[model samples]
Target: MISQKAKYALRAMFALAEATDDTPLRIADIAEAKAIPRKFLEQILLELKRQGLIVSRRGKMGGYQLLRSADDITFGEVLRVVDGPLAPLPCLSKTAYHRCEDCQDEASCHIRRVFANVAEATRDVLDRTSIAEAIASGQTEAMLDAQ
Candidate 1:
């Protein structure tokens, strides 16, 4: 399951991507526009900035913006940043793989095999979908409108 933090991060990224200008967006504005809690969003934005997904400006115009184009940022990357590795199980994780303690032989572990396939399918979709494509696909618009 996607954590609430990751969900908020995606919403904030969508709001930023949909902005008409390159100017940074104030935290309050993003929180309000996306209907995310301001305090929670502050923490989410900080984590995203630390991951190099976003950059911040200091001063009167100080705010946050994507470090790269929205098209360059994939849903996989965002989810990984906010939710840790995407793998549903430790044995199947690419970034943080660890053999399951109960598994005597990973090569023939039925549980591992099933979940590995599941993880790969999920990754396939998430990695191929970018923030820009997500917005252009109307999902984001529908979500915002529904709120």
Candidate 2:
């Protein structure tokens, strides 16, 4: 399941992506437009900026903008920033892979196998999904999972 924080990050980023020519968006406006809390949105956007997913502009009309093109920003990339890993188990996670201490043999671990498939499925969806696509469809994993 996609966390609320990840959804907000995507929504906030999508709202900025929908902007013309990197024009900045005030956090308040973005939050209101996306129905995110202003303070929380600020924190989320800052983290995204720190992660190089966005660029912040200062002063009036200053808020945030995508550092990269919407088409170039994949859902997996965004998900990674907000959520630690796509996989439920550390062993199943590609980026954060580490053998579970309790599991001496992953070859026979049913839980690891199931979660590995889930990770692959999640990654396939998120990796192929870009911000531009999300904007066009107006959909996110949250929306998909809600159904």
Candidate 3:
């Protein structure tokens, strides 16, 4: 299962992606817009900001915005930022790797091969999906309209 962290990140990004050409909006606005819990959204946004995905403002009319254009930010990239490795098996992971403790053989492990393929397919799909596409596809929840 992808972490709640990743889900919140995606939801928040969608909110930001759909924003007008005006200024950024507060975390509260994002949470309310996406129907995410306010505190949870704050923590997720902070991590995303730290990852350089979203930029945050401080003080009076403070808020957050995407650091890069929506098209430039892929779903896979956001997933990586929030979920770390996409692979179920450590050996199949791109960012974090560790051999399976029970598997002694690497050359003829069909299980690993199967998982690796799954990981590859997963990566391909998410990599192709961008925040811009998410918005352009009009794939938002009813919460978006509510906000």
What lDDT does each candidate get? 0.91, 0.85, 0.85
**Best model number under lDDT:** 1
Looking at model 3, which ten-residue stretch has the lowest summed lDDT? 138-147
Q: What is the C-alpha lDDT profile of model 3 across 32-83, one tens digit per residue?
A: 8888899888888888899999998788877998999999999899989887
Better of 1 and 3 by TM-score: 1
TM-score of 3: 0.91
CA displacement after TM-score superposition, residue 34 of candidate 3 (Å): 0.4
Q: How many residue pairs clash in each candidate?
A: 0, 0, 0
Maximum-TM-score candidate: 1
TM-scores for every predicted model: 0.94, 0.91, 0.91
TM-score of candidate 1 relative to the true fold: 0.94
